[model samples]
Target: MKGNAELLARTDMIVAAGGGERDVAVDAAILTNKPKSANPEAFLNERLMSDLRPTLFLAQLSNLLAGNISIVHGVTGSSRTFMGEEAAGVDAVRVALARIEAGQSELALVGGSHNGEREDLLLLYDAGGHMLHAPFQPVWERRSGMVLGSLGAFLVLEARGHAEARNAKPLARLARVLSERSARPPGAVSAALTRMWQTLTPHGARAGMAVISGATGAQPATNEERAWLKSLAEVPVRATGSRVGHGLEPQFSMNIALATLALGREKLFPPADSSGVEREYEGPLERVAVTAVGHWRGEGMALVEAVT
Candidate 1:
């Protein structure tokens, strides 16, 4: 909220976004009663007004977050919201960066958030075979099991001159953002990442550069991403979901932010597993590849370079 009122208004285009697991608590409260009827949609419409407290769809719809930010922040320039969970977060930053590169927006704000601690969401993910049932484990350590996380994140972007004029130093430079939805049919996700790596790998990816991954420990996708990462060999990788739990919508933005933090710190965070998958490098931390693999249907990567 402070960001909406303060930082967002200072920008030329505000791209505040995020939607996965945003309103599960409200949804869980409303859809509590199971209909005995075969037609769930019919049951919802028929008993909608009578059973629920005057139709609380406003509380459940995801766009309310964006609208609220506008009303509170006075960011009246242009607004857009993207939905579809992890991919939504990826697209938000992608669009913002595109607009900036096009010179359409000099000052911009972009990021995402997720409130993941809800029974309904956990059940939904579990039903889809995406939730972790066992004790907490590092993302790469467990083949299955995604512990949901509650988180919010945002970033302020400005053109080089805009920042220099204001004397605001940047933490890191976002070289490029590449996001895509994969029609994943075995091996497709890995193939997509490999292709993007070919495009995004600036000079040649070095052991000094690292990967900040958004693998949510969900089945084949997670396993697939791990295999692709291992193929890079010697490039240290950190699975963000392992430490933050899985904040579906905000996961990508959070990873990018963490990557910038590491770039500034000039060191990678310690590995989260003993599985020997995450290795260390003595080389200086320079570039970071931020990855986001959707639980169901998206794969993306972002390149962040150290300012030096």
Candidate 2:
């Protein structure tokens, strides 16, 4: 078989191992930044001021879980600082993962929300690929436009044994989560593509499949980025930006929602249907990749992949 063909077969195997075509329920619920009011200022004040304190919210949510939960938040600018003193995008995620590994916390709330100029967020299976802070790029700096939005998400994870112990409903079982860094330059289109390639590659380079989504825009390097992705082996690639729009916080939540829905229904939700993007490339995009251009204010560019 050709290299691309071998890659595709490996992808199919990975997807199959991840409970492919299996539907699972969300034992609990995931709430985004949905407060009482939709008004911008009021919502901002509530989220930033008192209504939803990051640590408090995380702890409170953790209490609701049966066992271990991984919470992931993607933020930009001022809000990033407010969440934690960590200076990297994946710092919060790493903290959650470490806590889980150490048995420090059974349920972990990991996620971020940022509001500032030039905001972006992304979630990947592996913490190593996450860019907590965007690197300084001359071209990106020259473009003056940054509007921070409010977006946050939390997940409740329970180990199979723990869930059975509590007699809690099994919504979904996390089959496998992998994180890897690419040799490509930081914040470059190639970097994003490389990460995606690594993400969808099946376990042991065997048969597997995956569904991918994220923000794709008309920004600089967008075309080149798409071109490179198109040249990859045949696999399904879906863009989520059409429905949710662009931003780090919301994208994280939206991607989680998509993943949950996929697991529950055993199907892939096309970007065109969700985000309203007309152009979509599907088929053998087995090695799926998602790229987020531009800085993440205080937290840099973040590229994430979640395959099940």
Candidate 3:
């Protein structure tokens, strides 16, 4: 009865939820009705500790989301949680796919959720110079960087045999998913993407496939991914952040879900900008290569292909 039984439900299963930031409790000091002291920073730690219930601290257990889902939805399956900004979500999918392909799992649910509006999260990101300021710009064009976005996404993955047993019609096939982490020197990201692209290209010609990039409007990383994309054969490329903003942990799942839809419909969505990096595709859509480049770490790619 996992709350998401509508998508995936079983007495035995594995569920993974990837998250960049797990909770919004860091801003508890500002939420208090009490007046701010001249030096609130002096007693910030004490005040926050006193305000929170004994059972709950400012550091929220990222797994509570899975717990809640189990409680509400009745999914009594084994669960795992990972936290590492953008890479977490990508790994979640990678693990689920591995399990299925290895005959370790028949069906599973995996994804992530994000709340971009939290003041505390915003403050932290702003401190890092990651927040995009006013005067809107697409992810590629934004000089100030990523605009946070709230998003929740999940995917139901089933093995071919399991799917055939249930007579379920899959919209698309996950041909391959690969994830890697880079030490992140200036050119490291581009090199990583090129290596990943090579792995995804053997499935078919580079010209027939489109790319759905999880390029958050963030710096160095976005530009690096852009450069890597330029080195590839010219194909229709879409920067999802331009339309959905940046959803961090859930970005990989969100982009994969959207790419699946595009593959199912056999069409590409409208491009978000006129950067010439993304252009129109005239052929029937057959596959999409989804890319996820983290703001600070993690690089991943998924090859989604049409089954029929």
Candidate 4:
């Protein structure tokens, strides 16, 4: 059986143990223990390579094949370190996609994990020597501490004809995936907005739906991102992310979850209730978006459809 089924079974067992209250929400759980290491960095590195890497690999494969995957993850200061000249995570995804297009592999699994420990009041640094630093906002004061999280994400793509012949289930028909970076004039938020508007409008026309996830706290960039999304008035827009908080890992997972839910359940989960701002948006606000300003610890944040 798949890990998700096993997890559900385990949850069922727990619920049965507690007399199976139908109305009870399952609290998230984690299992952890200490391992020996000469230093904190060494310990995190070992865990990343051994435990987290393989887990993410499996999760990615499952995501591509069965569309059922679990993200067992943690994060820490050390795991954020840059390794040599290579970028990680999404950059890795870009490279893997290129390789697959070049016939390197039929499918690719891509993901990352991070962990941290306190070292003389400094967080553990990965072998790449990067350290964790918090966003400059005062709201994050409580988040400045050691953390451990893992992320597992993957996608399955088949040669168009192959997928058609096999009658395989497709989670989303990926029309296009593109990346852009803009180094605008120092104060040109307007230009940034214009560029985003142009890029998204055409895509919205093609897809007929767009999901926007914005960041939390004092990051006005989140607002800017949402505005750009709103400017794409050609289609219905669903926003998410103000609820679950913001970080790349959680955003990635939450976006996938939203997409999966859209493709499967035909519904969107509600955004988290972090900001006092009431949910506002016209039309079907059934998609979500997320942003992260700086460091995050504890349970991450995500925003989804208010009505599940």
Candidate 5:
């Protein structure tokens, strides 16, 4: 969805994205034809100069999406793009929310996009042993690796009074959002989550509360998050990667959207994993804690509560 025209015109945007798709056909052609040329170096240079169009090069710029959104949708406000694997997504929302709280901005659009169906992208992850080659499995059930999914997501975050001024209906209220980064030693992730949780809910977990997790089904991160989640004993946990697969840069925003939806409907969706990690919750949902433990680097959490 493009969004409301009135809101779009003034909404600041923060996008978290990775590089663009490569020209696989051109790459294959150059590899095949270059070796055949008598002057291989000259031929390779010529193909690169001709085949790599300026438009194609421009597409690789992470901020290009923000510019295109502005041009197409008339959202001409200040724009920014962040580009660290999963942390980019967390920080994108963090900065947007911070600006709103500080009165620097009244409304903002925050999120990211990912294209997982690319040969170069797959090769890059596969080389690092971060991809799942076998049949697909839910995030919590997987012993190691992740399945990449292509997706784009965005959320309109507006100050409460600003939204009320326009008579706009609110979804869930964002209580607090926190992020942390560590060297990721054995227990670093678990510790980071513990601190963020304490900061978000100083009074402790409440009834009708649930968790929407962004666990990527990758190694130590998943295991650590699973362990930390156990501390929230009765809170129902749902890992969306089981249903949508992992879309890295947009994972945090996607999970936050899901949390808002659940709070809006006053019900959590059925658990996607059979492993004891995800359990069905039939109670009226009131609050949700969204967790993002990056497969490689960052840790963040947000507490969202139903608007009474």
Candidate 6:
């Protein structure tokens, strides 16, 4: 469905960004004058050449948002920009769904964008104690940290015969997109989310299963992903950072596009957490399991369904 000559010679673009916003008053005047600079490293390179802004290092250059999305959505064939923040949006949709399932590209434009009202990204997540100044809970009833949200998530991944040869109508079915990186140690992010949830549900979690948690309520990785989501008994979990508030690298492609719009509206949207780990599902919402647990490192999982 990428017209404009397949978005200029076959669309492909992966981007999960960072290194793009800072200059909160030139980082608060170089942390209030770089330790009373008597020559503190040449006054921090003369306040980084007169207090920044030679286009602010070419606008912070994290591939300049894939070079401005290949110049305003002309999606120039092959492009990537994954920086390690929320595992660069889970390996930019697991390398654009593994380069369209190994044929090596057949339309893609993964996702990412965040600007959570940056005061230098809330002073780099409040210097790792990880923001969230309390009182506005609901990321599994928080009590830990994180609460940054400003988003722009994309998806448009194609190649079910290139989206049925362009007639296109796939709102879901990115069957699997797993990833891991755990040196976390104490039950390491719930054993790397139980080995990527038994390698994305190996005959488990059925019956209209639901989950759309990019659970960034921080701390011990959201309490080890709420203890591996209490083994999914009665599934129904939803923590799009408790209603859109943790956009770290576009929060796992914005919770896999909010679990493909709640499996294309078959349901599953209430329960903004009265702490039952999100419940109140009125049932029948086909398969959707999108979890990314990167409060301080990456661990991903995906398994959206219902494209039928």
| Winning model by TM-score | 5
| Candidate scoring better on lDDT of 2 and 6 | 6
Count the clashes in each prediction: 2, 48, 7, 26, 0, 0
Worst 10 residues of 1 by lDDT: 13-22
Best by lDDT: 5
TM-score of candidate 1 relative to the true fold: 0.87
Of 1 and 4, the candidate ranking higher by TM-score: 1
In candidate 3, what are the lDDT values of residues 1-308, reduced to their tens digit?
Answer: 13456444453333334333433464544546335566666566566666556455422577877766667766665677777888888888898899889988777778878888877688888899888889888877766488888888888788887788778788789888999986898898899988888888866487568999999877798888888878765788999889878888888988999999998888999887777677777777888999999887899999998887
- Local lDDT at 93 for model 2: 40
Q: Could you give candidate 5's per-residue lDDT for residues 186-294 as a string of tens digits?
A: 9999999999988988889568889999999888999999999988889899998888888999999999999999999998999988889898789989899999999
Tell me the whole-model lDDT of each prediction, alpha carbons only. Answer: 0.79, 0.35, 0.78, 0.33, 0.89, 0.83
Off by over 4 Å in 3: 1-50, 53-59
Q: Give per-model CA RMSD.
A: 3.5, 16.2, 3.7, 13.4, 1.7, 13.6
What candidate 4 gets wrong by more than 4 Å, as runs, is 1-88, 98-105, 114-151, 164-167, 182-197, 203-208, 214-220, 230-241, 273-308
Question: Which is better, 2 or 3, measured by lDDT?
Answer: 3
Taking the tens digit of each residue's C-alpha lDDT, what string does model 6 give over 167-198?
A: 77888889898988967888888988888888
TM-score versus the correct structure, for each prediction? 0.87, 0.45, 0.87, 0.45, 0.95, 0.40
lDDT of candidate 2 over 1-308, digit per residue (tens): 12333222221100000000111121111124433356756665554564444543443332222112111221111111113111222343444434555665444434443322321122221132322233322221212222223344444444345546756565444333323333335445555555545554534242224444443343333444455555544445454544444344334434444555554555555545422222354333222233333222222122222333
**In candidate 4, what are the lDDT values of residues 213-291, reduced to their tens digit?**
3233322333444454445455343333333333333334334445656645554444333332223334343333322
Candidate 6: 10-residue stretch with minimal lDDT = 1-10
- Candidate 1 lDDT over 1-308, as tens digits, reads 24545545656433334432344454454477545567778766766545455334564666667667668767645677778888888888888888888988877767767778766677889999889887888988896878889887777666777778768889989889898876799999899898888889846747578999999899889989988998888788889887878888788888889999999999888888777778665568999999999988888899998996
**Candidate 1 positional error at 242, Å:** 0.6
Those runs of model 5 whose alpha carbons end farther than 4 Å from true positions after fitting are: 1-7, 35-40
Q: Model 6 shows how many backbone clashes?
A: 0
**Candidate 6, pairs of clashing residues:** none
lDDT of 6: 0.83
